[model samples]
Target: MTHALVDSQSLPAELRPYLDGLVRRTLAVCGRHLVSVFAVGSIALQDYRHGRSDVDVTVVADPLIPARALRELAESLAHPALPCPAAGLELVVYGADFVGRPCGAAGYLMDLNTGPMLPNRVSFDPADSADFWYVIDRSIAHQAGRLLYGTAVRQVLAASSERDLYAAMQASVREHAGGEGHLGDNRVLNGCRTVAFCRTGRWLAKREAAQMIATSEQEFRPLIETALHSFQHPRSEALPLPSNDVRTFLAWVGERVDEAATHAGIGDPGSGTYPDG
Candidate 1:
């Protein structure tokens, strides 16, 4: 079993130590045919917080690593125990063929090389970039970009920007929402698209106007409400969230937006300066 560590430059300085140790431990446990390991998600992009996120590490190996082996690998990473809170460490496992398809924003995954029973290298397209503008505009986008893994995770981020990732997310969303109910699928799709476009517009506004938004509410309620209306569902199902659940999700996202802006140190939208007219 050979292991290739992701370059260090891709991870946030704060996450590197934990991630490196975790990778080493994972290798020690899964010494069975562990071909290579790479870094994915936020930390790979160099933008994670010490307390706000989980590290994303991608482990690629021979086919069928078994769920049991994967679980053991997770336990091993914490063998000596990680310094951060126990709740924060998470391990996500995928097949050498896990790079299935690009459904939504997660982008499509394609095989980079051929191998015996499984492929070793794969590519992902995630939404990012100033042109794309969704990367840092949305709170989720901003948070997702902060991930770190392996000994040298930075190399992956060096080749990728938010723009290259735009498709990966789209792919993931589509896959999640797919199935029999056309209306149900479309409803979820609308919500996802609205968020995606809103992030894009927000990015544009910040770039061109030097302000976060125009006609601002404390959050995105107004925009979400407006976009929700664009879907042609009967008024009964029109609110997006079920009547029982709408308020809760909205309130949750509302708080998140406010909190995210504060953390980034973006003061309230600057008041337009004008002489009395």
Candidate 2:
């Protein structure tokens, strides 16, 4: 097995052992079939939080892996010896054929996460029903992702163009907006960032996007600050329950998201397979 060259300091101390085990275990599972693996999300952006972050990884395999190989990979990841120390371990193993495809339906071999408060859950992420956020992930992995092992990120991963990203961001927001419930921080911040990216072609974290947008686009400051305060995780223990203002703000956001979706020409957000329903 090849030892992937990475800045060990980029990962939290508690997660190092788990990451090592993950790499070795994955290599064990796929052997020669494994093409490359990469670090995704906030880690690649160098904005990962120690306890708050999930170890996001993308592993690529030769096309059409056998069921046994997939099972072996999953079992290796869930091994007790490789206990996850952070919020969770999120992994997406894709087939080699996924390269250069839009893959709006991002099927994965293993997509699971275990959190401090949230329970360990394995996702049955069918390609058709996958979340559109994978579009954003694809962009991140291709544009500025840090390599974990094997081939370089840009060489292996296919990136959607800026226009595609805009379409995807709008699609994701439109789905949430049209859905039957209030939008959370994930949706709010994502919506804000989508607007930012549409105008300025930059992918930033929730707070950073909010701050940046609020600067030149002063009209969004109140909504952005509110989203920054609400954050992503549950907050009943720390703050009061949602007020009317929260819902009102999100409603406005929903309208904006829908408008953005229309302008970007991402029609029929509902046409795709949706699992959240």
Candidate 3:
């Protein structure tokens, strides 16, 4: 795999102070119970649109707090604006979802879903439904430098990278597609393809997630038709097409990469594919 070159100094003046303050406040509020806090989602990736994005922050705490309550409280705290340059800000507390919850942000395009009590940032996976793994993987592969909790975040990152991501995807497919809830079966298979591609050095983990996020229901469905055709994986069979058209989707993602590269002072991975998604 190609190691991406990045200049950590690329952080924007607009984001630095806010992100730093977030870390300090989080640790102070949660105190000893706080395991760690890190930045993920769009902000860390530097893809946030000026008027459309909110800083995505995750805090891991002991005693496993209820995410709903945490989200509500956080939203209330940030409701009047947290004195940041971004249009808005939202904080999400992970862990404590018994009956499958919204995977990412409540009203936003992404969710930080994952298992309970563990701390790390991630993306959404229809197959595993573990938002934790998704965020952790994404953080390490693309925008982890934005992380705030130092050692705690580092431990999680080390563990995730130890295993082959393709293997993880296969396990997710077997467990979700061949095992239990079928909501994201087709996604599982596609995830498998993604993992395999990355393993073979054909794709980066960040690029893989971007491709999945960029995939369209109309044109991409046929690609995962066989996997979704089955009833065993009910969830996957039911995933509908995303709202945005292919052109819009690709443009959004393109802007994200450019913004991220600029903010992080990293090379922008050009839009790889925009096939009528």
Write candidate 1's Cα lDDT for 166-209 as tens digits. 33233323332332233332333333333333355222211121
Q: Rank the candidates by TM-score, best first.
A: 2, 1, 3
After superposition, candidate 1 runs with Cα above 4 Å error: 1-4, 66-68, 85-87, 100-194, 197-277
lDDT of each: 0.37, 0.64, 0.40
Alpha-carbon deviation at 249 in model 3, angstroms: 9.8
Candidate with top TM-score is 2
TM-score of 3: 0.40
Residues 36-119, candidate 2, lDDT per residue (tens digit)?
888888777666666555678888888767768876677678635467766667777777777546555555655655545335
lDDT of 2 at 174: 56
Q: Which stretches of candidate 3 lie over 4 Å from their true place?
A: 1-10, 46-49, 64-76, 81-84, 87-90, 95-145, 150-152, 157-277
**TM per model?**
0.41, 0.78, 0.40
Error of 1 at 32 (Å): 4.9
Scored by lDDT, the top model is: 2
